[model samples]
Target: MQIPEYQLFVHPSDRNELRKNIWQDDPITAKLTIGKKKYAIDLAYRGSHIRDLRKKSYRVTFSKPSMFRGAKEVHWNAEFKDPSLLRNKLSFDFFEEIGCLSPKARFISLKMNGKNEGLYLELESVDEYFLGNRKLPNGAIFYAVDGDANFSLMSDLDNKVKESLLVGYEKKYGSEQDEVHLQELIFMINTLPQEQFETEIVKYINVEQYLRWLAGVVFTQNFDGFVHNYALYRNGETGLFEMIPWDYDATWGRDVDGEIMEEDYLRIQGFNTLTARILAIKTFRTHYKNLLEDILTNKFTVDYLKPKIQELHDLIRPYMQQDPYVKENLNVFDHEPAFICTYIEARGNYIRSQLDVLE
Candidate 1:
C-alpha cells in the first residue's frame, strides 16, 4: 500500500511555544494538506508522552465539522516507541473482523514545514462522526481517562459527590453533565444479586459485545485497555452501554511504554471488577470460555494472523526504515514481527489450557 502524505504548516513561534507547553488542549492555528485538498485545522499536542518526545502525537480538529475521508477529526500517533509500528492498526483490524465497533486507521507519511516528521499512524477519532459511520446508535460517549474508572463500585463510593463517579471519565458527547445513568450502571454492577445480575445487566449494557471486547483485549494482552483506554456509549435504541477499545499501540506483547511484557502477564481476573464479577458466574464463565475457544480456533490463531502481519509489515517497512524518530532498538525493527507471531501462538495455547482448567 502506498502511504498517503500529510503536510502541516504552523507558525514558527507557535510551534516553539507549544513545545514548551505540556497541555494537550492548547491548539495552534495550522493548515493541513492531504493529497490535493487543504484544510484549516487546530493542531494540539496529545497523549501522555507529549512531554517526552520531540515528535509528538497530535489531535487535529477542523474549523468546522467537515469530513475528511468520512472523519471529522484525526489522531496522528507518532508510534515513536513501537518497533513493529503495526500494533494499533493490527488490533483495530482484529476488532473490526470480530464485528466490534472500532476506529479506522492507516499509516501515513507526515511532513512539517517540508521536513519529514517521519511516519505517523492516522486514526479516526471516536466521536459523533465515528458513530454515524459505523451506523451504531448515537448516545452518550464517555472515555475512561484514568485508572479510577475501572468499573469498580468502590471507586464510586470513595467519592461521595454524585458527579465523582464520572471523575475519571471524560464525556465526549451528550449535553447533560449529570452522572445519573453512569451511577445507576455502577450501582447495579455492584449491588445486584448474582441470579438477577445477568438479566438486569443486559437492560443497561450489551453483555455479549462486552464479552467479545474483553476477549479481544485479553487475547491481544492490552492491559491498559481493560480498565482504561476505552469508550463507553449508551445505545440510543436499546439504552444499553457498549465498550469500544482504544489506545492499542501498547498491545500485542508490549506494555504501554513499549517495553516487552511476559506473554501471560495478565491474569484472567483482577484486571477489572465487572469482568471478574461476570466470570465468577458459571453461565457467564461458560459463555466467555466458548467465545475464547471460537476466537482462538477461527480468529486469533497464528495461521490466521501470520499473513496479515506480514502484509502490514511489508506495507510499513519502507516508511518505518526511514523514520529517524523511532526509539526502539535497531535490532527490534527486524525481529519484532517474529516476536508478535510467537506471541499469538503462545497466548492462544496458554488461554486454551487455562480455559480447560478454569473451573
Candidate 2:
C-alpha cells in the first residue's frame, strides 16, 4: 500500500529507534505535521499486524499529533490499530443512516511505508461554554468523554449537575446516594409533570431522540447505555439537555450466544414480553413507556439499522465457518424477530394505558 506521507516532526530518540528498527513491541513512531500544526505521534496496534508490516501490535490506536509553536489547530495522523476500529467506524456511519445528532469523527484510508493504514477520526476541541458575556468554567456543568474521565469547566461534581439531575432529591442524593442509578434517575424525572420533568431530562436525551437511541441499544445489545457513555449537554440557551451516544466498542454481536436466536435481543436487554411486563408492573409505567418508545421509533429502527444487524450476521456467518471463536456459534443474529415481536406487544400495551396522556 502506498503511504499517505503525512508531514511530521519526529523526536530524535523515536526517529533513531525507527531507523534502527529497535522498537519491536511498539515500532513506527514519528511526529506528523498537518497544515500548520504538529502533534505527538505514536504507533498504534490493532488485531495483530499492520496490513503490511510482519510484526503485530494490537491494543492501541497509533497517531501523531501536530506539534507546532503557538499552533492553535490540532491535527493527528496515525495508523488504525484499535481492536474496535471496524465497530467504531460502523457506529459513526450508523449515525448517517439514522439522523445524526451527535459529533462524530470522519474516517479516511491512508497508507504508510507500503503498509495499509486507516485514519481513524478527528474532532474539533470544544472549549468551555460561554455564559452570557462571561465565561463560566465553574459550574456543576461537566462533560465526560468516557466513564473514566470528566472534563469540567468547574472544580468537581459539585451540586450543579446534582441539582439539575437530582432535582427535589438533593438532600437525599449525593456521592453517598446509592439508589439513584441512571434508570432510577429517569424514573424520578418521569414523576414530574411532563412539562416540568422534560425541562431536565430533555437536557440529556429528549423523548423522541431517546426512543431512537433505545432502539439502537436494544438492537446492538449495547448494555452500557448508562449516563456516562450517553451524556446530556445542557444548552444554556435552550435550557434543554440533548442526548449524545459515544464509546461504542462493545457491540456488533460479539458477546452473544450463537444458539440463542436473534428474536430475543430485546429480551436480553430487559424488554422481552414477559420480563417487560413483570418489570413494568413492578417499576414505573411511564419510564418503561418512554424507554420502549425511543427504541422502537428511532429512524435507525428501519434504515441502516435492520440492515446493519443483518450485516453482523453476515460477518459472523463467514467467521463461524472456521474461526474457533464462532465455530459453534452460528445463530448469533436470530434475535431480531423475537425482539420485534416482544417489544411491539409490550410497548403496544404500555401505550394503550397512556392513550389519554399521549393524545
Candidate 3:
C-alpha cells in the first residue's frame, strides 16, 4: 500500500512554542506538504495523556478553510498505544457500516522538518465541512471534552449543581441560538418527570440515531465514550440532536493505555445520565436491544470481522516494522488480528447472553 506522505516545515521558535504547553490547543505558524501540494498551516500538539509519549499526536489547521481534503483542520495521531494501530479506523468504519455519521480515517507517513516521524493515523475533522461532505443540513457541532458531558444536572468537576447547562461541551460549530438549544436539551433531560421524559425526549433527540450510536459504543466496549470521546450534532433540518463517535483509539478489547481489557468491562446498557433516562423507557430500550442483536448476528462476528482485521493488519505490517512504537510492541502487533478476532468471538457470546438484561 502506498500511504500518503505528510511533511511539515516549522521554524525552531514556533516548534519551541508548541512544546511549551502540551495541554493547550495553542498553535504556532507552520507549513505542510502533501503530495507536491503545500498548505499554510497552524500546527499544535493534541491529545490528553498521550502527549507524554515519545511519538506525539498533532492537530493541523489550514489557513484556507476546506483546502485539505475538504477539511480546514485534521488530526494526525502517533497511535503509539495501539498494538495493531487499527482500532480507531476500525471503529469508525464499523460506525459507518451501522448507518452512523463518522469521520473518515487513513494511515499516512509523516515527516517533520525533513525528519521521518514514522506512521500516523490521519483523521478527518468533524465540523461544518464534515456535514457538508455528507450533504447533511447545516447544524451545530459540540465536542464532549471530558466526563462532565454525561448529561447530568450535577457537575462532575465538583459534584455540586452545575453553574451552566453547557458546562462540559465545547461548541465547535454553532450560533448563539444553537448554544441555547444545547442548554435547553440538558435542562429538559435533568428536569423532566419519568412519563414526560419518555414521551417528550424524542422531540429533542433523534432516538434512532442515539440508539445506533449507543449500540456502536457498547459493542466496541469503549468505556470512556459514553461520557466523553464523542460529539453532538444538532441537525438543523429535524431540530433533533444526534451523537458522533470520536477519539476511539481506546476501543476493541483494549483500554486507553493499550492494556488488555475485560470482555465484560462495561455493561450492555452503558453508564451515563442521558443513557439511563433513555433506557428507562421500554420502547427505546427494546429498539436498542434489537440493534445490538442485529449487529452481533452480522457485523460483530469473528468470521466477518477477522478478514477486515487481517486486511488492515497486513496493510500496515510492513510499515509497522518502521515505526519505533510499533517496533517496541512488535510481538503484540503481529498477534493483534488473532487477538481481536478472539475478542469478537468472546464479546459476541457475552453480549448475546446478556440480551435479556436489556428488558
Candidate 4:
C-alpha cells in the first residue's frame, strides 16, 4: 500500500490512449505504452522524472497544478507504511454500498506490466469553485482524489462560502492569512445548527441523502475522514455544493491501538475540540437515528452489508495473516461496531444537553 520509490505522469495527450489499453483484455508494460497506446499515470509534479505510481491514487493527484510539489513528494516516504492496496479498495467498495454512495463513481481494474495493477475508483469530472475564488475559469474540469470524510466536509463548507458570497458578506478578518483555512472550514460547517446548512444542502443538492451517508460512515467506524481525501463541486446553474469521498486507506479496521473507543468515534465526529464543528446532541440524534434506522430497518438494512463485509473478510484474510501491521490491528474489527454504537448513544445523550443549553 505504500508508494513506489519513483512516480511520473503520462503526458496529457497520452492519457486517452493509456485508458484504452488499460481497459483492454491485456495491457503491456508502462514503458511500451505511448501517449496513444498507454500514457503514464504519475503522481509527481511537473519536471520530476521519477514516476512513483505509488500503491494509491495520490500518485495521480499530487501532480496537479494546485498544490506544492515538495510537500506532496515528501509524503511518498510514508507511503509504504500503509496497509495493502487491496484492503483499501475493498473497504471503499464496502462503504460505497453501505452508504449507498453515488453511483456516478466506480471501481475499475487496470493492468500494467503484464500484471493486475489493482483497482482505480474513477469519479466523474467536477467543476472547481475554489479556483473561481481566485478568479479561475468557471467550468474547468478537475479529477477528485481524497478521502470520504474530507469530501463530505468540503461539500458543506463550499455551500457556506457560496452562500456567504451570495449574501454580500465582506471578507472576514484574517481569512486570507490563515494557512490552514481549509481545515478550519470543516469546523465552520460542523458547528452550524442542523437547520442552518442541512436544509439548504438538501434543497441545493440532496443534503438529506448526504446526512444519511455520513451517518452510515459513522456506523462503519471511519475515523480518518479528513479534508484531503475528497473532491468538491458546485452546481453549474444553482451553484450549490456537493462532495465525493476518496483516499480510503486508513479506514475499515485500522485504528491506532486497535480500539474503536467512543472517544475516538466522537473525535472523528468533530467532538472534544475547542471548535464549532461539534453538533448539538438533538441535532446529531435527529439526523443519524432516523437515517440509521431507515437504512437498517428497510430493505437496505445491514443485511446488504453482510456480503460486502464478508467479501472484505475473505479478501483481506490472507493478507491479515501475513501482514504484521494488519495482524497487530486485528482487534479493530471486533471493537468497531461497539465503538460506533457507543458513540451513537453518547450523541443521543448530548442532544438532550444541547436542548437544555438552548432553554
**Winning candidate number (lDDT):** 3
Q: Rank the candidates by TM-score, best first.
A: 3, 1, 4, 2
The runs of at least 3 residues in candidate 3 whose Cα sits more than 4 Å from the true structure, single-residue gaps closed, are 64-66
Which tens-of-lDDT digit does each residue in 319-356 have in candidate 4? Answer: 44443324565565444444434544453344333333
lDDT of 3 at 263: 91
| Candidate 2 lDDT | 0.38
**Per-residue CA lDDT of candidate 3, range 1-359, in tens?**
57888888999888887787778787888888888787898888898899988888998889944378888889998888888899999999999999898999999988889987888999999999999999999999999998789899887778998888888899999999999999999989988999798879989999899999999998899999987999999999999999999999888898988999889988998988889999999999999999999998889998888889998888888778877556777788999998888888888888999999888
Candidate 4: deviation at residue 141, Å?
7.8
**Could you tell me every candidate's TM-score relative to the true structure?**
0.94, 0.43, 0.97, 0.45
Better structure of 1 and 4 per lDDT: 1
Question: What lDDT score belongs to each candidate, Candidate 1 first?
Answer: 0.81, 0.38, 0.89, 0.37
Off by over 4 Å in 2: 1-7, 12-31, 34-84, 109-141, 145-205, 255-359
Which 10 residues in a row give candidate 2 its minimum summed lDDT?
A: 124-133
Q: Candidate 4, TM-score vs. the true structure? A: 0.45
Error of 1 at 88 (Å): 1.0
